[model samples]
Target chain A: MSFIQRAVKVPPNSVSLEEARHRVFDFFRAACRSIPTIMEIYNLDDVVAPSHLRSVVASEIRKNSSVTNPKVIDMLLFKAMEELNNITEHAKQRHHIIGQYVVGHQGLVQDLGTKDQGASGFLKDFYKSNYF
Target chain B: MALRAALLRHVRIPAQTLNPALTLTGGKWGPPSLRWMSSHDDHLTKSEVTERVLSVVKSFPKVDPSTVTSDVHFQKDLGLDSLDNVEIVMALEEEFKLEIPDKEADKIDSTNLAIEYIYNHPMAG
Candidate 1:
């Protein structure tokens, strides 16, 4: 009940790139702070530590590092916040968290050797998840 | 009116005057060391804070452990970007169980500053 109330209370849109940057850091801190509860709810203790999860979240944000527009950043932040809210609220099941964040885009087989060097790009993508 | 004026004149006090006893005791009884017992006495030493801060920085995945030192800059020296800087600060916050304000957190760009800030923080433990 309170979670819904808190979720709906959005701040005004950031007017400048600087403001948006600060907001991103705030969001990052908020996400990092919630790692404990997320781990507990999803039973991720054996799989991931808080620091590792923090790095993963950082890397996810780093993927979009080229974006310079404040409005676009705000939109992206909203989506990230929504995803965080869902995860923390237990809207996601254990396997969902494990698959998306824990197992990662690499899928189950973390090939470190040259076995996949000869495989076609399509086959590699097929082996990986459907998402880009 | 006359009585009131006389009372006012007699009751006036000087600005520079202070209680001698209060000054002698430093506002409390006994010597300064024995005046109060607190957990602050066991605050983390500078060496311990340095070692812990270095360990946290070295443990960061992007940072090369061999390149990390007590005075290394997160961005300029370690080749990390701004986001990595924030991430390292967050890691330090978790390690120390301290919630550093964003303003102060922003200023901690190097290992020296992180060590100094944590060492000086009274509630860092």
Candidate 2:
């Protein structure tokens, strides 16, 4: 049996040039202003600096220059938000050593014993000092 | 020693015979203001970059400031892993207010390299 796939057509030039430019500028401005605060709060200052974030945003804007439709903008914004949330969630999970430890029997043995007793001891000491 | 003395003698002759026009200007072209402005922020010098980089490295809670030096390697000498290296590079990007490309950022594995990179970067302020 043969299957046929349908191609979807996208409308071009849906938004005015001026409107596109304004929206792009607004997006960048909002991103730059909030990125630093976000980095600080998330303890991401070490992993990604505000300048890096700005550069990434600028590149993303440049890449999507042809996108002017409001619906597309909303979709892109939603996608970006999802990506940021994922990064934040991943960072939060990775920030704690306990979260990195495996739960299954073999995984637990590998982490606590096979992986180096010194590191496990250090983790224990760190847990005691920081948590208790 | 002889070369040093000869250089000193040449310098003394110029100082003793200071240009009359320069003296008559009454310190109009004095270097003090130029030095002050240069230190204030017009440029990023090697020493300034070194000091700032050292301070940032020292600010890490796990790092001992006294152990930091220009010659120290981020991983080999400082015992920082790759993630810590990323953090340090990010901190440098923030301090210099410049976006270091990932390719270049990856190469900055030591305090000395960071100092050199910042000192040579034309856009660094």
Candidate 3:
């Protein structure tokens, strides 16, 4: 499933304090890896600037410095991930509208009326629709 | 005018050269200007920095490539808080092979920001 879909399985306010404490570090690790990707996706116009992204991340970490709850941290991190997914997905769709995201959508080619829609079918349809 | 709270504590970045992924985030490595990416240039190339970083993060049981993003909150997004930041800092320090001051720990939140900071700062070699 896509990133946003995972949020449905989690309750927003259900962060367990114990989990929050242990999970805070895990959240940071993921955030660090994701920064570059996030920068690429939301940075379409460079309007927000990389510094702002960094600053917000740093700011969030600062607030949780004292929290020892792992679950709480996990839920918080999960929320951020969901937001990022939503924003980026929206950005991708918008880009599709403007034709900027065209090349990447070639994955849809296989989904065309080809007999059996397998992964290859999706790719074939994706290329035909998006590329051709 | 706006007060910035302590974000993270001591995120250590290694002294080693970073990969294209992290290095590219700064103004180094390639042409100063942005040109269209060519077929020869796949975006996944990593420098020492990237490898070291990936090593540290990949060691963790939680992070997946799909879930990583710029806005993923360290605490909320990846499930990290202050103390974990400490471990992250130490790992980065080892990976990049440098010293990250405790005082500076709170400031390094995103890898993009860290790359930007490191590029501008004196320590990144």
Identify the leading candidate in terms of TM-score.
Answer: 1
Residue-level lDDT tens digits of model 1 in A86-105:
88999889988887787788
Off by over 4 Å in 1: A109-127, A130-132, B1-38
TM-score of each: 0.78, 0.40, 0.32
What would the DockQ be for model 3? Answer: 0.06
Top DockQ hit: 1
Instruction: Find the 10 residues in a row with the least total lDDT in model 3 chain A.
Output: A97-106
Give the per-residue Cα lDDT of candidate 1 at B50.
93
Best-matching candidate per lDDT: 1
For model 1 the TM-score comes to 0.78
User: Model 1, residue A2: displacement in angstroms?
Assistant: 4.2
Candidate 3 docking category?
incorrect
lDDT per residue for candidate 2 within B1-125, as digits (tens), equals 99999898878743367767576335766655545545445677788888898998898655788899889998998887654576677767777887777668768899999999999888887
Show the colliding residue pairs in model 2. Answer: none
Give the TM-score (0 to 1) of chain B in model 3: 0.47
